[model samples]
Target: MQAIVVEQITKSYGAKGAVKALDGISLSVAKGELFGIIGPDGAGKTSLLRILATLILPDAGEAYLQNLHVVRDYKRLRSLLGYMPGRFSLYQDLSVQENLSFFAAVFGTRIEDNYDLIKDIYVQLEPFKNRRAGALSGGMKQKLALCCALIHKPEVLLLDEPGTGVDPVSRKEFWDMLQRLKSWGITILVSTPNMDEAELCDRVALLHNGRILAMDTPAGIRGSYERPLFAVRSDEMYRLIQDLRQWPGAYSCYAFGEYAHLALQQSLQGFDTQADSVMAELQQYLESRHHTGIEVLRAEPGVEDCFIASTKDR
Candidate 1:
């Protein structure tokens, strides 16, 4: 069964149509799945999430949560959905326990009644139960927010960039917690800007410029990458990039990590081209100009590389 369904959803702001936050986005998440929307800022991820949570109305199209219309059945849907927005929206004056209690009260429940639902997470916050919400660390605040979101035992969880401001270790831990939550049969839809996080999802939709570039498992997305790629590094990195871009045999070149990833244009001389040949020519060209420390080798493309390549094509 589909936990959430969005069909041709669109949202815009300003009289001149200055911003098109979401543009005809259509997607669905299966029940009990960990789905991810991977994209950088302004990719329409927040807009889509708000629409699905029934917090904001779409300018066009329709959305449903568990076969119930988001617009027409918003009151009923609210009781079944948990949302953690991009920004931490908890009350600053409230204590950790108070915040959780407040949210539970809003949902017509008490902490003890649904304590089992958030027990694992709430234990970590128990030490800070009496502390003000605003005083917690970024990671701790994230944990507290999550506990509050799940307090009501919502069937569908919508998290927007839950790890954006947290430390690397905390980010990993948060994802691990999410995996555990998935086993409890809750449908999760998370949005994130980190490419590494995308691989954690059962399926991911790559959003760029308010459009869906691709949607598939991480392995499937990586398998779609074509063309041989090589990483090149030299002492004269700046000059190398400029020169390589102008090189007749180079199809594309861009900075990646400590080296530049390059896609070479196929040889027109009907000769079987090899990495050695390409490196030899590049080395000679640089050496004649008094350059040194040149290194070139074939490298596997990663998720970021694929994202860049796909968005560049669009």
Candidate 2:
């Protein structure tokens, strides 16, 4: 059986249910598979994770973790699930060791019972075992939270934006830890707004406006961009993007790091779109716009590129 299953789940908040958090969203995760829910803020990533964590019930449809229904079998499922919420929710006054011990006791387990499960992580926190959780660095706090969640050796882990507020190096370290945990047969469903992180997941679901825009491996998601893509940069970066967006043949144009990635429409009215001719014409057009230092090169589609195009298409 699949490790996690969600079918046609929906949620809304506010008076008369004016806000729709999820719109018939459905997906599943295989045993030990690392699945990602990728999207920006207000895209319902938190709501979806919360439902799976059994923090709240979905308005319609059903969800199951390890074949235990999220609603009906929440009590049973809780013992098998480890959740690290986006925000730090641990007791501020308690030291790291105290917090870990408290959570283990709550679950009726001793820290030694699952020492092997979290030893790799706790070593880093051991030096600061007496430091209050609230006083720890952002990254340390995340590590402590993760350690608490894993104290019971849950079969499935739900990490909600564990990278947020942490430094880039810490973020990388955290993901590496996750990769290690997956090897131990734990199903992981992590949610993040960082598009770059999507590549690390075995599969990802791109979500926006309370709905899934696309779901596939990172390579598969990039392959969905059927248009010709190019990276263009010039002396006037700001003006270059404006001109590219206004260009007649432009299908999608947006800033990407040092260059603005432009996806061209294959066919444009009275425009010769043959690759060679298109590149030459684009240069000529930018030159005419009084933009100097122009450089345009065909570019491969990245997860971020595909994300923007998908959002526009939807």
Candidate 3:
């Protein structure tokens, strides 16, 4: 059974219909599956989550959580889903235990009644149980927020960029905790801007500018990349890009890390004379003009590389 189903979901804001936050987005999360929405800032991930959580209504389309209509049965839906918003929305003045208790109470439950559901996470906060949530570290606050969300034992979890603002170590630990949570048969739908985190999900949808570029497993997405790319770097970086772009056979070129990734227009041309012929001509042209320290090597495409390539195509 599908835990969550969104069909043709769309949202917009401003008087002139200025911003289109979500645009005809449709997706489904299977029961007990970990689905990810991978996108950068302002990609409408939060807007979609809010709609699913029944905190916001979509301008069009419909959504269901565990077969319950999000809009029609919002009151009942609230009792069956856990949501951790992008921002830390927990009360700062409340102690860790108090916040958990309050959220549990809201759903007609007590901390003790569901302590086993969150014991692994709650213990870490137990040492600071009496401390005000405002004074906790970024990682600790993340943990507390999650505990509160899970206190009611919801069937689905919606997390929006849960790793943002936390240290790398804490981010890794948080994802590890999510893996453990999956064994409990709770469906998880998480949104993140980090490319590395996208690999952890069972499947991911890459979003850009309120549109989905692709949706598939990490390996499957990577396997779809077909072009041969090269990383070219030089001490005279500006001149290298300028010269490379002007090269006759170059199809596309862009800066990546410390090197410029270049896609050639023609691949069959041998690098020895045809490809190297162009490079040597450019090198000599550069050397004649007093350029120095050029390096170019063939490189395999990574997730970031594929993302850039896909965006460029769009």
Per-residue lDDT of model 2, residues 179-204, tens digit only: 99998999999999999999999999
Query: Best TM-score goes to which candidate?
Result: 2
Number of the top-ranking candidate, with lDDT as the measure: 2
lDDT-better candidate, 1 vs 3 = 1
Clashes of each: 0, 0, 0
Better of 1 and 2 by TM-score: 2
Considering summed lDDT, which 10 consecutive residues are worst modelled in model 3?
Answer: 267-276
Q: Write the per-residue lDDT of candidate 1 for residues 220-304, one digit (tens) a residue.
A: 8877777667798999888888888887787788998799988766632433356678778877876776768988787777777
* Regions more than 4 Å wrong, model 3: 236-244, 265-295
Q: Which model, 2 or 3, shows the larger TM-score? A: 2
The clash tally of candidate 2 reads: 0
Which of 2 and 3 is ahead in lDDT? 2
Worst 10 residues of 1 by lDDT: 266-275
Residue ranges of candidate 1 with Cα displaced over 4 Å: 265-273, 283-290
What TM-score does structure 2 among the candidates reach?
A: 0.96
Whole-model lDDT for model 2 versus the true structure? 0.93
